[model samples]
Target: MRELFGEVIHTYTRAQALADGSLIDVTETAAEAGFRLPVAVTRTVWLRYCEWPEELGTGQSTEGRLWDVLWLAVWAARTAAEPSARITYTLGVVPVDDPEGDPVDVRLWAAITGEGAGGAPVVTIGAPEDW
Candidate 1:
């Protein structure tokens, strides 16, 4: 993590690895940024994601579905353990670069472990496609 203008930023390599399924443990990285729990980190991300383009559903509300996804991610994170815990979720159909074209689905992948110093929990988050 790099501190710029008093804000913590994840390096491009770290961000790419997170999305590409390479760098899975984020304990030390998040700790350095002042985040302690996977849910806390995920919630912060979800809130930011909510600011993006609207994703209208066919028979349901997109916001409702997103909340459900957020809930599941948090629940999964709470139970995450070292060596095997993973949190995977799909954001259904979302607006893509072209709003006039068909929307695409967004997927998030994460893992948690206890390999951090002092057995601190580690969390990693990534999306398969741009949101």
Candidate 2:
């Protein structure tokens, strides 16, 4: 493919994204939620769902929110009929600024990469549009 496409001009890798803050590594938290593979979340999802700023004065913790996301992903993956490259799931999240408000349903996607490419599979979770 590279030969047909000629010399590569540029490439942006997942590692670069992680280092640059475009992708937040949540592998540790994901593992605790029963995931064995590496996991990450796009910055948008991080800010929208996982992040719980102190100024919000809410009881919600970032770790708890992140766990909810990953735990739901794990459950979805396990229940899927067949293993695929992408898995979509939805979860309810109470807004940080409005903790008393009804939970909003957010659809998220988890994509698996590096399968037959010889590297271990990694999971990236993001908003539906992020895919």
Candidate 3:
């Protein structure tokens, strides 16, 4: 298991950040180096990380999905970007300990600075327990 921190904001939020002048993208960058986690699995892990809003509903509910929450978080970051904004995200990958089975990567991320009243950020991405 290893912990990694990224100084860069999410590419999903790049356009808004550039428009706000909070961040400037000199060039396009490749996606983060890691397995591309699925949205359904990411949703499950994120739900485990924090409480779900009544409106957003739960994992079993048919309301807000992981993609929805992710968009919400990105928008929050873009909207909230300011001279003092220090919001950040950290990713932790825990590899499967099995010796015979192929190693599986379980990834999770948290918003470090700008999360508000609720312990959860406006949005978060994570890996499911099974995936």
Clashes of each: 0, 0, 0
Tens digit of per-residue lDDT, candidate 3, span 13-81: 423434564332211110121212211123244444222344532232212333333443344445565
Query: Highest TM-score, which number?
Result: 2
lDDT of 2 by residue, 22-100 (tens): 9999988898899888899999899889998877755788888998999999999999999988999998998766867
lDDT for 24 (candidate 3): 24
Q: Kindly provide the TM-score of model 3 when superposed on the true structure, using C-alpha atoms.
A: 0.23
lDDT of 1 by residue, 60-79 (tens): 44354445445555655556
TM-score-wise, the better of 2 and 3 is: 2
lDDT of 1 at 67: 50
Which residue pairs in model 2 clash with each other?
none
Of candidates 2 and 1, the better by lDDT: 2
TM-score list, all predictions: 0.37, 0.88, 0.23
